[model samples]
Target: MATEVYRESFERRTKTVRYLRFLEGLADTQVGPIYLGMWGALAFFSYLLCVFITAIGFGEQVGYNPIRFLRELPVLTLYPPPPSAGLRMAPLQEGGYWQLATLFLSLTLVFWTIRIWTRAVANGLRPMVPIAFSAALFLYAAIYIIHPIWVNSWNEAPPHGLRGILLWTNHFSVKYGNFYYNPFHMVSIFGLLGSTLILAMHGATILATLAYGAHREIDEIEKSDEGTHRAQLLWRWVMGFNATAYSIHQWALGFATLTAVAGAIGVLLSGPVEPDWFQWACRADIVSGLQKACVP
Candidate 1:
């Protein structure tokens, strides 16, 4: 009996290893190409979305967004008297609040997803329809990469005054926002959007893929096929949920894109942006390269 149990355990271990190896092989072949343009596009689109959100949500006063919090805190500063006599500049429109609020919310959502979505994916009840999954994959991955890059840009800023420091901390000015020299521009903004884009596409491509697959699964069931029907149904539900999430993700991306573009435009016209210190990382501005790898 002991010998038999040991043999069974060994066999199961061998099977598990083989399964992993098979999956790894498939991923290398199928998923490798997917990464090529997916990351770069993801970054560009998502960054745009973030900028749009920050601009409109916070209103034109988007520049002083961080000041609100800073002013309320322990720091004391001399209050400048309002424009003396008729010198008032059209009350600088201020509206970056919502953008900042949403950023926090989005961060929280990602945190919860790690706790919740990660577990769900791990449980094997994978619902993502292929196309939706692909698009969403593009969006979120970009968001993640951009966040860090943007933050680092702020910290690594060339020496400037307190105003510059404050502006860097918040989206006071995208040109001065510190991410002007992003290495991201070099790689091509293809797939950097990651999960955010994937989630957005989930509603359409993902939903369609799920519906088609589910309908076929149900048909198989009606034909008296057994065992896999329940699994198919579960997968169908997963796809639907993903579609719902993607819808929200797309909404966020749309918002972010508009915000970022507006910010980029404002800064570009205002003055010189960051000097490209890492020009080597910037891809050669070659037409062939653009056609071949940067087309997306």
Candidate 2:
């Protein structure tokens, strides 16, 4: 009994020491920055949430029922504050909440991105996650920041309601000519669809092979395990090639990253670069017989 007690005590001490050492290592690696960034992001996000809730309340006060607003035309929306409002807080009806929400949102994204980068670096992982996330951030900035700045009006940015954003998108497409003809928009759509297809294919393939005892590790599958072997053969027969476990992940990452990157590029190019995608398409001979309609 004494021996067993000693052994337990020693084991406990060893674990405690290891935990302390791990913490020390984390400190040495500057985990504080990660925590700091996360806290900053959380704070901003919380504030933004409050702003949204308040905006909803204001929407209700404006005689528009929150629940039924979607059913009505001219849908309830939190519009951007006028430029004349400056940085001062205005009444909720004057768009003060939206301006504050936008500011908090921008800060939240920045801090969250920093946290992602720091955490990935501390864990010795590739920066692919943060890099892919940056593309999404770029798209947001293009729509809310860059585009507004280019047009010299914050009102150019979308409002803070579902139908509001939909209306903004329709207005944007109409004012800038149909976005369907934009090459970047086409690429983005292709990437988005391709990512969805790849996700479905990979998930279905795995599930289909599971019944065949294909739950082994990738290395085991590569060694001609019966179930995984059949899977490989099935894919080879259907597509003339098969993706290994490693390669399938690469494929997923490429498609997902391309979707965001292409979307950002499309948003950035929409007004400043192309101005009118439909008109450009007509000039490029990509479409004909609609020049009169594409005059805008």
lDDT of 1 by residue, 1-296 (tens): 55568656766655333234566744522222122133334444555565554344333333446675355333312111122312222222221233233344345444433434444465575533333333343344333223323443212221122453364435423433234334343222323354356545443443455534433433443543232344334446777532232254555555445344433333332223343312312343433333443323
Each candidate structure's TM-score, on Cα atoms with residue i matched to residue i, is 0.25, 0.74
lDDT of each: 0.37, 0.73
TM-score of 1: 0.25
Q: Which 10-residue window in model 2 sums to the lowest lDDT?
A: 25-34
Q: All candidates: CA RMSD in angstroms?
A: 18.8, 8.8
Q: After superposition, how far is residue 96 of candidate 1 from its true place, in Å?
A: 11
Q: Give one digit per residue, the lDDT tens place, for model 2 in 1-296.
A: 55568656766655333233566744532221124455556856766685675566456656656566545435657777686754456676677667767777777787777778887888799987888888788888988888777766677788877678899889887877888888887888888898899899888887788866676554356565566677777899999999877788788888887877787777777777888888899878787677677554
Give candidate 2's whole-model lDDT.
0.73
